[model samples]
Target: MSTQFGAASTTDDVLAGVDLKGRRVLVTGASAGLGVETCRALAAHGADVVGAVRNLAKGEAATAAVRAAAEASGGSFALIELDLASLASVRAATDALVASGTPFDLVIANAGVMAAPFGRTVDGFETQFGTNHLGHFVFVNRIAGLIREGGRLVNLSSAGHRFSDVDLVDPNYDTTPYDPWQAYGRSKTANVLFALEFDRRHAPRGVRATAVHPGGILETELARHLGEGEVEALVTSLDERNAAAGLPKFQLKTIPQGAATSVWAGVVASADDVGGHYCEDCHVAEVHEGESMDGVRAYALDPEKAKALWARSEELVGETF
Candidate 1:
């Protein structure tokens, strides 16, 4: 039986009585929203946290806020620079962290861009694909050595992955029409595939990985690219569908609520032996058969495809496992 919690759970609720003293954790995009909450919760539980962010100013402010929150709650925190859109930035940040020599007990790959317009990164890759997925791929491989035995890695995926997979023949829209949603979907799928492959390759060494859907929390950096109308249309559509299907209307979760599933996947006892599982609402997601548009897409879980993506990613980032 799959154990799952509902969207109502908060970070404190999920992490109740859990102690993270001496644990080292890295959370990307911790400037605001869910990332801030996750950082505060883990720090409050006694974990030493590293907030990896893009802008130094925003990062400093966010770090200050997190530290203040943690101190208010009696906890600790720090910050690091990591611009996921730039390969050079990723390398510089990785080199600094590696040099620090602090082995990470947990890594929450929580940074990502959502449905953004057509744009490329400094390395000439699609912005969404580059930052939301490729950057993380390189980041994970770079830090694979830092993860302690029994460490865990969590990738933040979304239901948006239902839109598509990596366009193997032309992943960068080099010869086709550029569709932002498709690109975002491909990136999210990559998140899942990355976790699956990472788990397969590292679980034997006592390192495990999981990908999770953090529920539809509208109040996030993920929606920064969407216009008010687009956001309203998407939100309305989902709400209407839920009503028609007799399901609960999608509600914007509090930051702590949004961070719950991630915390659960990162440290819950019930998930001790669970790796390579796509999770949501604090539990292992069921394999959906009828609709390819919902749940775990086949390509996302295909070990062969996962391996292939890893190889291509290595080539792109010039990093080898």
Candidate 2:
């Protein structure tokens, strides 16, 4: 009840009493890092998992790895190709799932890019915003029917959302200058807002949605764009933000620790009860102000902004759910 599961807790630690037998789970970007661990943990607990990835080869390898890790639990793993950057791919993946008619208990939107140079996705939106937010948006809405009653949408956001809010006016940087971190922040903010609105619309049907900041830097492909000195610079900036917020210095987490909150949100019945909240370190995070570098900002949780984002997303994707 305290949600005090610290940065040291792993998916296994948080999921101790939670039984996932026969549950159907999906994880995006599941080939490595937190995604792999999330699948392993779920599968280890007897949940059937399908890891959606961009590459079939990598996905197969990841599935094997997770399967091997999960042998002790008598669980299973499967794979499907899903490139969030391409709506065509997302549609195909959803079609495959719909064909299989596997009702999902949870869908984790875990794949994302970070701090890359200015560019646009194939759909012409900013790379980070397009892939991280819009891609997940379309995929989730399309599969809304495939989600069983009381299912959960776990959008993996970031505490870096403290850096900025969604820029509805210039989301694609058509009229404004682009800053990488700011763009990433906007996407993360959108992730939370998306979950907020998603809960509003889907709750009546018993499906709930929530966003999570997995907490701290872990070794993942998401950071592939970072340069030599960027890691230290990012940490220095994070420390400064923590100092400004009167918080303790942020500590880096292990891969298992990084996946804890996500796993908690997905399978913990109590967490689903707190739908639409932003969680971190396996607890509902506090909303803070000004350079906190931790917690969800009030703006990210605003219902109005969430609705506005929903509208904008519909326009961008040229489709409405």
Top candidate (TM-score): 2
Please give the distance, in angstroms, between residue 272's alpha carbon in candidate 1 and its true position after superposition: 4.2
Measured against the true structure, the TM-scores of the candidates, in listed sequence, are 0.94, 0.96
Candidate 2: worst 10 consecutive residues by lDDT?
265-274
Clashing pairs in 1: none
- TM-score of candidate 1 against the unseen true structure: 0.94
- Candidate 2 versus the native: TM-score? 0.96
lDDT of 2 at 285: 86
Q: In angstroms, how far off is 25's CA in candidate 2?
A: 0.3
Model 1 lDDT tens row, 254-319:
778889989888987343545898987777777764333236767678899989998888877777
Q: Which 10 residues in a row give candidate 1 its minimum summed lDDT? A: 286-295
